[model samples]
Target: MGKKCNAPPECVPDYSKDEAYLKTVIPTRIALFESIKGQQLPHRQSISGNPIKYSSFTIPLNYSGMIILRNGSVKDGKKWISTPLDIAKGISKDWGENALISKVNGVLWDMLRPLEGDCEPKLFKFDSDEGRDTFWHSSAHILGQALEIEYGCKLCIGPCTTRGEGFYYDAFYGDLGLNEDHFKQIASGAAKAVGEKQPFDRIEVTRGQALEMFSENKFKIEIINELPDDKTITVYRCGPLVDLCRGPHIPNTSFVKAFACLKASSAYWRGNRERESLQRVYGISYPDQKSLKDYIARLEEAKKYDHRELGKTQELFFFHPLSPGSCVFLPHGARIYNKLVEFIRNQYWKRGYQEIEKQEFGLKPMNCPGHCLIFDHRVRSYRELPLRLADFGVLHRNEASGALSGLTRVRRFQQDDAHIFCREAQIKDEVKNALEFISSTYEIFGFTFDLKLSMRPDKYLGDLETWEKAEADLTEALNEFKKPWEINEGDGAFHGPKIDISVSDALNRKFQCGTLQLDFQLPSRFNLAYSAEDEAKKERPVMIHRAILGSVERMLAILLEHYKGKWPFWLSPRQAIVCPVSEKSEPYALQVKDQIHEAGFYVDVDTSDRKIQKKIREAQLAQYNYILVVGEKETEAGTVSVRVRDTRDLRDESIEGLLKFFRDEVAAFR
Candidate 1:
């Protein structure tokens, strides 16, 4: 990072005696923002700190027209003069009061930002993603004000997390150390900003103006220097602090009725360890106190089910500083991982998929290119039209260091990845069948799911007609699958349109783990072709990239948390444990364990000195699916007493009977 700006005299607080330099002792800035913003000169160079440069950039506000709301209601508006908030008020008083953000023509437009043209409007309240993100984002700016006023920190960047909640800001605090003890002052300052009900005023500024205004802060200067010459440099002011942002912020600061400082940590500037270190402070905000309280409760509840903690206790996985974003699976973790792969393999078998393998170790980001070569290896007739290929080979990509999280975001991972090469006529059937496969699999894991058909992005790989056809196929497939799905406009891969699946776990948290992406670009680029039914012309097959368990490592994490370590019988590493009631029955317990293991199930014999009850209790705590107890009567009868995990049900069963039961559960995919 550039050298951090020291606490300049203007930055020095008016209320603190510790201020070695105060506003009264400092030279005045060139001009107040309000006084200079109205200057429309094409190239104004007369400025104090830096030579000023102004652009004649202006938004046209002359077009008067009608805006069509999503519900078909029409509102008269003037382009660049009217905003989503104005149209929202035309709809209803409640909408005007509660709308945190609005979608103008399916784009996330700020409620306060002027409409560019006549468009359809959809207002979002705090319950929606757009609204919540804006809410948290606005709160981050308030936090920025707090840090600026109280600590004189030079703010770097503040953004909502990619995770489901909250926001954080990275700032340069120079030599001032920060910790939880500093949270009180931060909170007090944030509260002061909130109480002021400052409007989030936004204005387009000249590059020279931006430089002169942020002349004291090199961090902001570095960002300003990188923008394209014609790009609009917008600034937002809330209370005393002004920031450069691409904002769709809430109308004002008072929207954050509840706020809390989460934590403080050290981070390298822009996530590059070679750069200067900065302080990152995280916080969460809500429009009401109750929501914040519930979020805190969930945080506490989530700790009990955190996958990393469970991984430690269950001996599942471990990470080392030497290998960031890569996990080493212990024997137990390997069992769980392999079990998931095996489960998907079983589905692949039932789904008519041919397993394919490729080299890994960061050589490729996905198995797509290799599979494309497989399909293009030779000319074939239309008879083998829908060729399906499956792979569990590891894949690697260069994920940013800051973006890596536990297993959810990893640099190295494997997926139950597959590709289907089929005819265009078969698109709906293939997609519907894929949906069925996903439904059955998620049902097994007890996950409820949501579907969205993402359309072609603005910058796409193929012709518009191809994209339209692909989107239509996905839309028809989603409709035929009879699931409620929404359109994610312009959210598709550049290669093609896709169906994105999000599964909700026990905590009602959603994870994007399944997808069916239709790709036309790869097949065309690979020049793959098959003989048509007429046996004269060659036809290119459409490639459908399918993934149920998107990433094996991520799925492991989700299942670990979703199941709360109570792995189902089929997936459990500790499927069964044979406990000997006494030393005399040790041999019997070993025999029983051997039998169960021979039946193709994971089984262990507990020969420890602990009493049978304690052994059973420990096994249950370890999340063993089954506990088998052996004693004199059971030994004589050649039977074992069995108890299911987390249950009071127990029964005595013959060795043959237990093996049969194991086979049944495996067959049923229990």
Candidate 2:
């Protein structure tokens, strides 16, 4: 015997410390929830039996006030003074019960949050962005309540996601095996709370009172201690649970009519991997079950078109633990990637852009620094003011492992990046030309995109005069497009303003991939200048950073999912496959293959022992653009039967004619 091969108990394959711990503490957690719910958690009383203090409103009960609607009109000319919820209920019989949240004087106000004096009110429905956020954020609070009730978990942060994705809540569960099995328990608890229609009663508390109330929970204590002195501390109570939050929640838990727990994952405390790990639960809620059902159906469709799954099936790319967040593109994937770059390069030559040489070592994450160096290499003429430099430089970012996905969120990638240096007077024309370039690029890909001018952010560089001029230039440039555009207020980069383009995919999902930003800081920082008419003065040039496809890897992923792996002839990695009906037609298949290859197309012959029909079926499964079958009769007639990817047959066409069709399609993109 080889030393008996004995190991410690920890070496057992079936051992899981978290599972054992969860099994032990689950009963106690449920008992705690039952204990809390048995007693009424009144808004006026604290756990310490001290009466909670709340501020009183100064508005007189007998005073009548004006209620201004969003449409620049007053309801009934002048209405009696009431809360925002009452005003909403007066507008429509069921508005108060159905509306997600309200807006008073442009501020996101809660339904029960009292309105002061004469107010302009607007109610948001669940369909709008604001409404969706409020509704989902309220659902997150309910999730936290359920978690605490089911697992005695210490609550952390629960907030709505940016960009309308969804909402999630983070909590600390000590050695608990939280998985899909427990999602139903959590959902049941949340449903019970929703059925109770508990009001989201808000109460202001002092730091001492809050600390005393939550002394047992260390996470809450930490949050309360780190808060700024000027920040107000508020606690929200729903049914038997209370949480510390700055909330403009819905009127009641009933507003979250449709709810479900999505999934659970482990995260570090406040995203620091060195700290104690926590569990983050993601969920989504809707006002009705039908809407939730529709979303679920769409989600199922999304899973089918997921790029990671398709990438494996199509042999496009893969990820390894050794180099997480980075993708290894196979031969076929590289072909499509290179083709995209070549298409953009051809556009560069046609648009008066000169390709610049990239750096050898110490490569930067962006091409701006290198392009700036090239611009300053040797330049001193007003005629060369608007110099355009382009590069497809490989870049790397150290993204956290938890945030890494397939191609959508990756670490190493390349951008269709370029920088244009020009005089301030040519800002408008440069922006106009850039907008046109972006539009043309999207049109070629058959994408419908929307443009918006991102204004100056709170923290930005350069003088206000130059910033204002750049913003005006971008605004004027957008006016020339002759299309309806919106303004995204105070969302520009730290350097300067920019025009962002968001494209809608085939699934009706929006992706913000293209941008053209005006930068006045980079050129000045690099000391780039050009000579004026006098040939003595050095004037700083304005730099414009633009990208149409953004990242090559991300664009490939989007196209893979957008087309569901059925690529068009121009972008397809494996354009055509030649299949022979029998062993005797092999020579004819090779001849046809050679003809397609001679015309600069990617073609291969199926020499396997399978039947011609089987070979054609495999080609279709492989997502080849075209399948060509050759038999004895076609071999003698010098023709091939063509079948498209989706089983559409094009009887028999001459080899030259088929090659011409593919060439024309490829040329259109070029």
Candidate 3:
């Protein structure tokens, strides 16, 4: 019954149509079988004119598979495999250039180079780390060409940087030195090189050929002579210039669409201080125009927030060449600094932490030794497992003058430091509490921060097992907090694992402000322990070193730049300025100032015989929050005309009412 139904209803085709359907289906089925057979077939074949035989197959990027040769030898392989030009030719017959590009790690490598063996390949885009380095390295060659054309400078070494925007090259500028004035000429020359759109041609040469090519430049010759005998020498050339380099550069010079000269400095050759100094020219380039614009805007904004300039303008701090790396905080600056200390002291007091003073010039470079002295002063019990001690201690380090910057890098600075002596089992909880304190303090300053866990350095002091346990404890603490943090491998202190908090300001510049360090070695070094509940047991207590604000002076500088000299009412040294309209109202203004002073405000009466507008302008320039104008109308009405800074609106309110308003604002700190 089913066969009959197909013949009439399901199979509606006539005899002729049935034959056509069969013909189409049979050929497709046969073709599928043939294609599958071809894929399984061995590819050992010789081209018409090629001297070597080759094998070929389709492979995906980064694929892991096995290749079985005709000789019964089996080899594990990835998408990338080491082969000579003959094998690549055979593979090229089946696949296109895209496969080759993926095989060589997305690099524009030479097609004839032999692939010797199988390995894992990494595909790269323009934004990948390796890709960016390759692009910038090519750009450095272009820069060398431009410099040669413009200044006739002898290039020594140019390399891409890991931390900064782009690359820098060291060169000798003959007798004339390169400075800011030469940037325009160098940029113009670079633009010409970009316009030429020349390819970066790579050439391999022997030792004799390299020696003859760079004989005129002694620096290049010296570097070449030191190379190992088995190493291959290569040179990259763009336009009319060539240099000795080991390169994986971009295809051509036209990729350098945007460029700029950042700075010029003097640096010793190979970073050796005893060697002769060469002129180092720094530059940055981008493939897109918008990236270049964004970089320039950030640089300009940084100039506005340059702490050195703001410190001088606000009369907050100063540095002298005699002291080099040390800063001298003025009286006004000291007022802000001491107030911050008081505020933190109050915080510690509320948190049940004991405040203690430490010696400024101690035997060690850190406060750990002094804290040990206090910890050992008296016998402690197991009940005091997490004893917190606070200090505002000054520290100094021997820093070179060349490494000094504004407030970010200084020799002498004070740290709002604390140490927690706790049992080994309480390490995670103590670290979590410390992090919470740091986050809350940063929130008060309206800053967003990131955490970094720094591991032990090469020159560490503790045993491997102890360091492992300390690292594990820190990892547990971070895991409990459940916050994302970056790892700075091999960058911690000698004796511990540490966490650094880098806070970002309004302009998106980061400043290092807080740190939490775990120290097991220091307690052992100082021989610190507490008696356990079991009368016979005494165990070493772990030490936690933490700081909310690394340095008061540095924090002040950052705040000044962050707020642009406009401090909040509570933090401002001078909260309000009372300016009398004329000499007649001076007495009333003085009385009003006294009233505000009595209300617990910092107020000053401007007794200068200048015009009222000049006095208001001066008050605004000083960044005072409020300017109280006392004239005949104000005195008669028992009101003061209040002119708020950075605004044009004026409010007429009674003296008592105005004082109350400031008190409320100061309390809120808005």
Candidate 4:
């Protein structure tokens, strides 16, 4: 039996009536002076004849502490004097030469932006995540400064994004058209700025002042007009260049040791097609020369894997102006696509997932709706708690032409999509299983991926309580797996929390390939439920939406780039090409090819009347994995001379042995 509740005073013992109880209930607070008795305050020094005052409050000396200025003055108890330059210097000194100084609060400001009124501050070291973003953002500004000096382009906007290699900026060049030819000049300019060690000077100006300063630039003027009159605009000045920007730039431009402009394309102002077009330059910047060299090497490696180039070389796929976004997969490309679908389908079959086919049109951009319909088709019981469904369905979205590139962005693609319907208690295990599957699949492709947990968005479908529960479930699953994941705040799907897997290819380029989402809203939206063990009651089962490979076309492109068209044995479109030494051995080569074809190898025989060297050269250019050479000596022994791609080494092996070897390699890929 529970005791009855009482009022606050009644619940507490009366000191006069119960003195012993009073002693146990109350605890005295420690005196502030005694609590910090053995501590020491940070030392302060004058800068440029300005006597900067620091906190007198005793703080732990062993562990560094920062004096944050919350209020305007040092006299205010809330205000703590700390200069930005001091913080940057402290970090750089403590973290060593590789340490980067990142600005906070829209000021990659000079390490010297004095702590003003009360504000929250954080110190960044070399490895801190915030520090890296700040470092990259500051690099963008340095690039902007260089552009201004070299080309005198009116800067519109430059921001760091998680695409390409590093950062990019959209600048409007009045009457001066910029293209790829200017990349070298821009890179040279940026390198010059990096050498200057220009400190990013941050200043807060009134809206009127901002308008006056950027009056000559229409884009900036338009941006300023949209801001409120009371708003304060921040500007970052480097060398002779000044631009209205809100940034936490690096301590100085010297930290940006290497930079390069990759390409230039047209972008609409503010990403709106209706707005004026601006020339956008894409570039990547690194901290050191080694990183820059590695990036260039990777770029060269990536060129080999370029899907468009591979398509042309292999005669696998083609794009036409008639149907811009739609791709025409040639016979070879179609075969690979079919093979991938079959592979994923086999996995689904072994996992007890019901393969479902649904209408392509009228389907939402997502695959969840079709899965919902399948879930509704049957009255599930608690005994069948986790029902898995998989699909390899074609999906289309309205993507602007400007947004499409290579295989990264496309309108039509197939998704290796699946949905798991499970009881609330089974959410953790189901999510873990999905993650394991995604990990294993990526590992097989020689990819390293990172996980990210995305939370609810600004506009969400469910109540706070539901969202909290959903988020908790996801967090619990992530914890159970013990995987390192970064959080993407307010960027989840409309209905739930999701885990996004970003995988890095051979070029060290990260692409979003896998996703696992916990959705309670979707089941309820579709009125889906399963019967309980009690026989009468029915409860809505939670839906876990997932996709191991987001799109077939995109993944193919990534693979093409990752391997540089030198696909592994099984994935190679042309696995082996047979070249005869002369017309004398042509008949034998054809016989060998037929035998290999019967064994399921993609074998081609060079029957053209050309020199044996020319044939080998052609096969090499085609990137065939194996080149088999046959001549009078090889026919007498009933063996062929095999040459592996990308190498000159030749080995003699019997026809049967060669067939066995190639089969084993292909099996390993599977």
Candidate 5:
């Protein structure tokens, strides 16, 4: 979860509380939204209201401006009056009809949000990430409306999935429990909202104003209180629902042509079990029915490869209520985990994965804090400028319970965490090397990934100039690699800018499993320094924080689904199994299995009473990468018949030759 970060992060119903205190939840929430909208709205205005305070630009009478489109073309527009949608319409009817979101000066601007001044605007369709997020975000509002109208449940946080497939909303229904039986009614309500063509409108208010607006809903109130008093809060109203959100949602509800309620489950408020329990309903919507149908098909396919399900069936891992958010890796799962750690440790040691300079980092349970302590322990020379320190120690985090989905987000996990200390001039080379290492590791696992330069967030801890230099170095390293990448504005850690790496699995789902971050704050805090060439000079070194396999547990989950439980040979716990043709060959099969085991690979002999074909089929179904069959002929020749999983093509080889092949395959990391 820490690497690239999860997109939108999920529960159950309660009492069958006889009647579950099924009191009708009043329409106060909607009335409140309308009340605020009324106060915020200018009388006698249209859906796109004229701004009273949001705009910083002062418009002259009939003020006219030009919108610089992405293609270097300019269109006549009026400040505080013309919107991106207006410009899109002028560009083409197709762009106007399908534009889901817009970007103004690199900021995600809602299509309906008015242009403040002469500015550059880029329109995006559903094909782009921004557009898809806006679409799904709006759909969540629709779902929230339906849930409120149908069950009077209190709506909570709702957003699109990490992959932009769909969205889900978490809500509290008191003791009232929910099941699939309610999906049809929910869908009906959602469809009704789409038919209404309600436009999504945004408004900003002070803390007191926001607190008053959501006074009737304790959940929204709780969220409101979490914000700083001086912060201006923005709320988006769609139909009767005015949600607490920072949004650039779709222009209106009519955009969703197809909608469905996928499933319902139980959740805890804010994902805390100690808090109020809630109901979580998942849903999806699309502009057209065909895309919805295609998505439904893909969902079914994805379920077959769901890591949680495969983990159970493959006897790899399991989760229990007693240890929520953490997985219990079985022996087989442990084998894979150990191998991954061992593999990475060996790679860094051999390849000299290091920074251009050296300094030690400090620790506050994380690797950096401890590494700093070691560096500061004694006076250090410039010769060891690039000190590479790696940690395999377990790190724990108090992740939200509802947010925990399989191993992707967990309370307990191990990271391939390491730190590099180098001189300022060496930053780019260190970053470039880290990028290359990331690519090589992903290539070994057959993964496709997206690279992003996450910029300094709103709140940061270093001098502006230092932050800028770190960002520039990372940017240069990315350009040097010559790969396509994008910027994730205001998405960096508070300490510094970072290079985020999101690995895409077989289903094209993205997981943030690796990142290389440049830090100035921590190094400064620890006062880590090294002797320079100048006899009296002591220079502070920069620290590069990195973790390639951000949670071995999470990566295993991604790999599980990516391969659909058929692990690649090197990573497979059940590398091979020998099946005896009959009692006549049982002894020979056992001998072969023992020999393979002694050679340092996982192997087993199937001594069951099942026939030859049945044994082979069972072994393949169990996902043993290589299946060995021994019979009278094989026994006579000191050889075994080999069959590959999925492709049962058989080839006979001597026992010694087969072991050599197995060793090569494992060593290749294929």
Candidate 6:
């Protein structure tokens, strides 16, 4: 059947079947969208008996336009001009193909969209964040198109994400289950669309027309009806799919060279449990196949180190449907978690910080409000200028069920959280100390980190001067550290400027686990005051909120993934295992385990009926740092043979000698 249309050619699909095309055609759910693409809505009617004529639209013959380059160069000519591509090619041929999007007069614009007027334009490529976001977001559209065509899915929302999380699209596929088995077909359809090089044409329509265009999909209708009347309704068309969006998409589908469907999961509509659930499909795309291969490799590595799987294997932590986001830490996991808290608490005492005990009725998502009460209870003096209070309070947040993942996104967690009440004169010093503390602490774990200072946001609460002062202090501290740092403009909390620390793991993936915010507004809000040095008046003290390990649960997840379940000896839950060759050596093995356990090392005695070698293998699989084997000769000689987890053998040493070496090794980690 032939499809007739009066719309521009670029607005329609450009599909071609080669000789290798499938012999059997699989029908798609595209007719609903295609019916309205090239025709006017029912509203365009003739009121009088005479025929009505609409104005003919055409490009001017001698359209003159000016282009502004980033280098302050201008290109002006008398030629027909519309899209950003025309302006780019007119300026320089090299920029025509790779340019991702343009910022015209501070508004993100699609390269294929016509320019409204002579405006300041900034073109961006993949290196720019704006460019990467637009590219990935457009990739989601391709994924959505493939899903709709292949399964007749009712699409909900598709968006791109940063921080190594690529993109996902939520769709309601009634009774049409999807899994990894369907990924290959979805990927093939998406790749075919890209090969067609269909233009992503943008169209502005009335709200009534938009409702009519997507009337078949109730989800789309619900979204359209909820949009405000003053909001402009725009839609983008590429290949066989049309979507309602306010897009700054790439010029065409061909820009996407490599793509893959990662996986699919269940999600509630608009993240509400009471509403209908949808299948959320996740995928990623890259500029080339090489990048995609690298990403796939990283993904494979990530799966091997996934905390949920590793937790089950290592017996670290587990989750139950009864308590959705709260983890049930096993004995071994609790030990490790407690050690992390103890380490941070020791630092508190050494850095002139006082420990504040948690209260009963005032517990909340953060311990800041309780710490505020502590500062207000006593009349502090400038002599005690920077009074630091530390807490390891348990916190609970009502994270959406759909958004919950392993330890990374959880409901219950503890933070190595603290608050420092300092005078204006001490802000710089306090922030400097916090940075140094972070560096020293991460160094112990062999973590290399990146630092960034977030400036005052548009809706910040404090006076401009205070925000600027806090920002200047943080900047100076960062500069003095003599390391590379980035400024996240307008990304600060409403109350203060903050410094975020992102740690890169062994796999070169980054996780943000530390934050230090200098708050001028919170102190005033809590009415926290201290006696001035003049001794005649009182003033509000600045509150600095800092967390070295933002969430202990999330940090544990990062460490598990980073080390691949092989923790350092100092932090390992099972530092060593005592295995005896025979029942005759069982008594000696028990003695050895007692010595290690009494010396503050976590050790277990394995007296299973299994052979010694088999026992050693089991311990290794459990990620035990050391395995000590004892037999008749070693027991009589008061010595033991120690084998490292990675098959490295050590010489048999006397029990006393072994104790000295082990203590020194553990001390080195501290």
- Models 1 onward score TM values of 0.83, 0.81, 0.69, 0.76, 0.85, 0.78
Which window of 10 residues has the lowest lDDT sum in candidate 3? Answer: 1-10
Q: In candidate 3, what are the lDDT values of residues 1-670, reduced to their tens digit?
A: 0111223333433322235523443344334434433553333122122322224332333222223223222223322223322333334443322222223432234323333344333323344434466667777777777776666555799888644358888876544567889889889988998999876655566787777666656678778999989888877667766778877566567778898888888876666666645788888898779988997898898788687887787687898988876788886676677777877887798776888855555623577788888999888898987999888777788765666788877888878889999998888888998888888778777788877788888678878887787788888887787766755667799878899888888876677778999888888988998999985899899899988887877898788878877878777776889999999999899999999989877789999999999999999988888999999999888889999988989999888798778878755655
Each model's C-alpha lDDT? 0.82, 0.78, 0.72, 0.73, 0.81, 0.79
Better candidate number, 1 or 3, judged by lDDT: 1
Could you arrange the candidates by TM-score from highest to lowest?
5, 1, 2, 6, 4, 3
Candidate RMSDs in order: 7.5, 8.6, 20.3, 17.2, 7.5, 10.1
TM-score of 4: 0.76
> Which of the predicted structures, 1 or 5, would earn the higher lDDT when compared with the native?
1
Model 3: pairs clashing at backbone N, Cα or C within 3 Å: 82-115, 82-116, 82-117, 83-115, 83-116
The better candidate by TM-score, 5 or 6, is: 5
Off by over 4 Å in 4: 1-79, 83-129, 145-155, 173-175, 180-247, 358-364, 457-459, 479-483, 581-588, 611-613, 631-641, 648-656
Best by TM-score: 5
Which parts of model 6 are misplaced by more than 4 Å? Answer: 1-131, 148-154, 172-185, 199-248, 320-322, 456-458, 463-465
- lDDT tens per residue, model 4, 622-656: 88889999999998899999999889999999999
Across 1-670, the per-residue lDDT of candidate 6 in tens digits comes to 1222345645433222121111112122234344554453332222212322111111111112123333223343211135567556654566676778877665688987755554556666665556777888899999988987777667889888557456889987655557999999999989988999988877677888787777656788889999988888988888767888888798888988999998898988778887776898899888889988998999889889998999998888899999899999999998889878888887887899999777657548998888898888888889987989988878999999878999999998888889999988888889889898999989988899888788888678978988888898888988887767766677899999999888988877878889999888778888889889787899999999999988999999888888899998878898989999999999999999999889888999999989988998898999888899999989999889899998767679888888888888777873
Candidate 1, after superposition: displacement of residue 621 in Å?
1.8
lDDT of 5 by residue, 1-670 (tens): 0121122321233313223323322355456666776876563244443432221111111112123333323245665678888867766678779988887777887888877765656677787667788899899999998887677666789989765478999987765677889888899999999999999988777778777766656788888989876666988888777778889889899999999988888887776677776788989888999999987897799888888888888888888999898789999999999999888988887868542233324322466787787778999888886777787776678776657889888888878888988898999998898888899999999998888899989889988999889889998999899887877899999988998898887777788889898888887899988899995999998899988888899888888888889898999999999998999999999899889999999999999999999999999889999999999999999999999988959999998999899889988886
Candidate 3 steric clashes: 5
Best by lDDT: 1
Q: Which residue pairs show backbone clashes in model 6?
A: none
Model 2 residue runs over 4 Å out of place are 1-73, 76-98, 102-106, 115-123, 200-247, 379-382, 450-453, 462-472, 479-487, 532-537
Which portions of model 5 show Cα errors greater than 4 Å?
1-74, 162-164, 268-274, 318-328, 353-365, 398-406
- Order the numbered candidates by lDDT, best leading: 1, 5, 6, 2, 4, 3
In TM-score terms, candidate 3 sits at: 0.69
